[model samples]
Target chain A: MEQKKVILIIDDDPDIRSALRVMLESAGFVVGEAANGEEGLKAVQRIQPDAVIIDLMMENVDSGSQVAIKLKEDKYPGPMYMLSSAGDAVRYNIDARELGLAGIFQKPVDPKVFISTLKAKLGVA
Target chain B: MADSSGKYSQSVLSKIIRFFLRDEEGSFPVFLHSLRLEDQLYDFTIVRFSVAFLIIAGSLFAKYILEISQLNHYALIILAIILFFANTINFLIAYPARKKKEKSSAYRFLLIFILHLSIATDFIFLTIALWLVGGVYSPFQTFFIFHVIIASVLFSPLISFAYTIYGYLLFLTLAIVSWKQWLPPIFPIGAVPSDAPPTGKYIITVAVVQGLLFFLTASLTTHLMYFLREGQRQIVRINKDLERLCDQRKGFLQIALHNLRAPISAIAMHLQNLLYGYGGELNDNQKSWVQRSLTRIDELISFLHDLENLSVMENADLLREANEFGLNDLIEKIIEENQDLILSKNHEIKIELPEGKIFILGIQRLIREAILNFLTNAIKYTPPNGKIIVRAYRYSSCVRVEVEDNGIGISKEDIPKLFREFVRLKNQKREGVDTTGSGLGLFIVRQVIESHGGKVFVKSEPGKGSIFGFELPIHIKK
Candidate 1:
């Protein structure tokens, strides 16, 4: 038996958070949730999640991306992905590698693609 | 006149000043007077200073070269210096009043009044100088016309008209006094005390002609100013209306897209859940329909994103903040970050960066967006296992970046159709490729590159692969 990978989902919208949680949980991953970037940071420290998905436009523009930068500065060793509502605008304004984001998922992300990427990266069956 | 700034803004004098403050008329009760028209007063001071220079030069020329004993060189030089000092002091004091970010209407009223007073006082000085020289018969008596014209241009027509009448009255008085020989030997320039004075009829005739000339200049200039101001106000009104309409359209677009995006995203998520068996098991037919709807929703999301990018690219603030960044470093970072995307397409990306760092001056985010557009576009249009060669190096004086891809190419004719906004291609939509182009992606790319003093270039044929690139002038650090 293998341990399930823990993923933290940070978003302002409860619906979006819940949707991500359902998709993650159903895929045999443990899902943790936070309402904002600050809480997400604390949650990452506490949960020590294997992966994190942050909504780029939570509370303010680029707050989620800024949080990712902070997490990377704090030397958190985990894969991070950003969910963007403004796909190209967010992509252009930020350097994904500078923020240490593994990838960006567009809003209403494809569940299969997201889950598969996480599963493949974590090397979990 | 002694009213507080509040009461003074509502005063009739202030109303008239406000009316003429802005060259272009706008809504009344608007905050802040234009600093532009106020700047014109500085122009007037320049002219006044030039006149002072001319006065000093002329008097010196008359004394030393022309050897005119009758002209009082001392008094003329003194007056010239006085004009210089007075203008300099007034400029230094009043210059700050117009430059404030927020202009009180009362402050503006004071500015106009001060300007009006200065021009009016100039006429009085001219009158005194004329009286000393020969009164109505003075050579510089005609100089009053210049002041009349200046007043007509800087102040309202009614004020100019009043000044014109005042000059005519002053002329009448001078003529009467000259006829009575009140100052027969005017400052050694006029007739000597022993010589006989001119007749009343002669004085009156000369004065009448001079007065008519004065009135003619004032009336014509004032009339011309009136028509020009009316035209300016009309154009300004039209421009304001157009601007308001454009802002409203942009606001509506932003709001409509934002409102549409949230609900559509929520719907897509729900649909995704159902398709993934969150609701229950679905038949094959249901699965196909759900996939189709999901694809459509994704396209809608992409279109909205493109639209937002369009608005963001046009933002003035984004264009204003320029930075110098290493071209190679940015390219390397972009490639590193987009490795997943490239790998997903099974495309082989070959990067050719200059050995040394290449610096370019531009809005960094906009430049990045443009470069990203070219890369993603190449990836999107190219078939799987296609080869993408991205090169950045010095080309002549400019640093050029090229994205060459071996994929389905566009004809020379279809090339131009690629960058236009919202124009979908008929021939380019291949069987396997997902072409969810808003047609704005390339348009945005062009805009961003062009704004950075760069030109985008593309080389391709219908069968062969495409090469898309741009050249930006190299930025050298001082």
Candidate 2:
């Protein structure tokens, strides 16, 4: 029996997190949720999900980017994805891949494509 | 009988004065180009009064000294008459041009005519007075130099030279006629037996020397005036270039600000998610409608981006190519564009337009954008089922178009800051609706209206209603 792959969703908005959780769960991945950047960081330390999804703007704007930088400094070996409502990662000039991020997904994420990209980065069969 | 005669004589005197000071036919406008028309008229008035005073005082002094033979009293009387005519003609021209505030080429020509006639008349009268005194040896010959200097300062080099040559000829003609005894001799009142009029070679020497003095004065003064004028023109040219550079810099700043944050990013994401079925499974009917709505939203985003840049451009010549447009047709199209939003909100829009065409001159696209912004703002702030009234009518010399809404009106403090860029008011809420905006809409609206030489107005009160409008000058074709 294979362990169910877990994905952690980090966003301040409840609606955004639940929609993403439902989509990821239906795609055959176990999904956990964190309400803000600080809770997301604690979840990363405790559960250590297969991949972490983060919203770029939280109660403190740029909180998502701060999480990524902190993970890199702590030598946390896991994939991170940044989500934003203002702009794309590339347009905002945030080099997600260089910051040890798997990729970025914009708000109201396209579930199929986003899941497929994340699975590819994680080397899922 | 006395009153009628007095009125009749005044009318006749005015008629003669007007005839003398009328606009000169075919005078060159090029001469008036460097001088301010109003200043030239003012200078003419000053010169006329000063010359009249100098002539009166000079002739009276020479009379008391008995420097002339029998023609002393005659010279005094003739000089007085010339002074009166010169001052009267000047007053006639200056007062009317000043009162009417006339800047036409004809008015300018009238000023130049006053300059020419006054100079000629003063020189001719002074020369005759000098002739009645001591002919070629009169002490007042130095005044011709003063006249030449005044001519050079008032007119262009060519015109000044012409006046100088005319004065020379008049003086020479008077000297020759008196010397050759071609005209009757009226000797000075107290001329001694030995005080014979200087003759032949002596008189010729005096005439040639005076001619040289006139030419020198005209040349030097006219040359200096042209140099000063050229310097002023260069300064004006530099000032215009600096203004254009400043406008370009402002345009750059606007572009930088517009691109700094992508305001449409959230809308793009949500629309993409719905159309691609990321939000959840959708019926075939739902998928088709979302896709269509997405296309329209994309178009609107691009238009807003374009407007963000366009509002900051202040190039006058580029915006001057305006065409006639009907205000009613434009409003109809704007309403049609926002049909879906209005329908979603269930808002009742009341449109009141005057009969016939309300035509105005402006860039149609810009005016359309302005109206679109106002309408969009009204729809956004108004609750579902709220009323909107759009009215267009002619007000005084301008055509005013207004959008009035009974919605969550702006507070008194926020009204003053509404037109500023990126200034969204705090604590904005209306029941279940939460308003989100970039705050660039009204800023663009004010920019568009003001660039057309028009004004924008706003009247709003908390919770009652808000009215936003602009007035544009009506374009009447000849």
Q: What are the C-alpha RMSDs, in order, of all predicted structures?
A: 8.8, 18.7
lDDT of 1 by residue, A1-125 (tens): 88889999999888888778878888999999999999999999899999999888778777987899899999888889988775445334777777898887767777777787888888887
DockQ of 1: 0.42
Which residue pairs come into collision in candidate 1? none
Per-candidate fnat, comma-separated: 0.33, 0.10
Give the local distance difference test score of model 1.
0.78
**C-alpha lDDT (0 to 100) for residue B19 of candidate 1:** 61
Query: Positional deviation of B305 in candidate 2, in angstroms?
Result: 4.6
The value of fnat for model 1 is: 0.33
In angstroms, the error of model 2 at B46 is: 18
TM-score of 1: 0.77
Tens digit per residue, CA lDDT, model 2, B190-242: 54233555588976887888888889888898998789778878989999999
Q: Considering the two chains of model 1, state its CAPRI-style docking category.
A: acceptable
User: For candidate 1, what's the TM-score of chain A, rounded to 2 decimals?
Assistant: 0.94
DockQ score of each predicted structure, in the order shown: 0.42, 0.05
Global lDDT of each candidate: 0.78, 0.71
What TM-score does chain B alone reach in each candidate, compared with the true chain B? Answer: 0.74, 0.52
Error of 1 at B317 (Å): 1.2
Residue B145 in candidate 1 has what lDDT?
86
On DockQ, the leading prediction is 1
